[model samples]
Target: MSVEAIVNDVKTRADVVVTRGQEALEVGVKTLKTANGIVVEGVQELVQTNVSAGKELSTLVQASVTKAKTDGLKAVASNPVAYLPEGKATVLGAYSESLKIVSKTGDELAKTLKSGVETISAKIQGQAPVVAKARKTATKTVAKAKKATKKAASA
Candidate 1:
């Protein structure tokens, strides 16, 4: 089955669950959205830390993707799906394929993220010392200007 079909099935299932209780549906959606937001923020922080640590960001991204795929598969398997008209084998096969695609995409993203992190780290590391020196020079220049101004005011 296509990814779209699997997603549609999940949506329908969630709707059915929601029909049982409005509060449950609202809570579930809110929790999922919050989790997604946290994940996005965590990824950004990981990228930034990789730049500072001079480490490859790809490893962190890859690990996260792998975990997400595993969690998704588990959720699909555990979810109640008796309402679907499809045979068990067909539904299971589709879910499995969907999981496989998610894993594959995650692996590719991990590689891309790692490469990007490495590049950013290298650039930052290369420029860090220069930036520090420039800041120090600027600080001294400012101090000198202030001293000159004070002397002039006194005279």
Candidate 2:
């Protein structure tokens, strides 16, 4: 081929490489944005779960305290000494119920985290093939350019 034709071919190849590079860059940016959205969603879910748990715990404690107070008052009207064992049992029951609430909260948090991780991983994995294909195309374009240059020089 003439020098002019060779130069044109090389230029076309370079353009293809640049276009592919841009496509790869765009895909990376999109992936990053998607990941950021997932993180935000995850955080929101965690906050909501924690708030719900807090409300439940607070309500339970309040109810338990109110009951204990009422019972104590009744005992005082009768015999205060008889109230001690019942008070201890009530406190222990409250503690046990509180532990159950905390355990449920922990479970909810773990599920949220797991869901976030799975979503992020799926997004990244989905983009992998597109990025790899772009890289491969870029590499092939470079190799072709090199070969064309060598042929032109020898000509």
**C-alpha local distance difference test of each model:** 0.45, 0.51
Which lDDT tens digits does candidate 2 get at residues 1-155? 89999999999988866765665566555445444443444344444445545666666667666656888776556875543333444455555655654554454444434444444444444433423443344334334534644554455
Give me the runs in candidate 1 sitting further than 4 Å from their true place: 1-86, 127-155
Note the residue pairs that clash in candidate 1.
58-114
Candidate 2: residue 120 Cα off by (Å): 16
Tens digit of per-residue lDDT, candidate 1, span 1-155: 99999999999988755554554344345434433433443344333333433333344446555655666766646763522233345445545655654454344344433433443343433332222333334334334534644554455
| TM-score of structure candidate 2 | 0.41
Clashing pairs in 2: none
Reference-based lDDT, residue 11, model 2: 100
Candidate 2, after superposition: displacement of residue 125 in Å?
Answer: 17
TM-score of each: 0.27, 0.41
Looking at model 2, which ten-residue stretch has the lowest summed lDDT?
130-139
Predicted structure 2: lDDT? 0.51
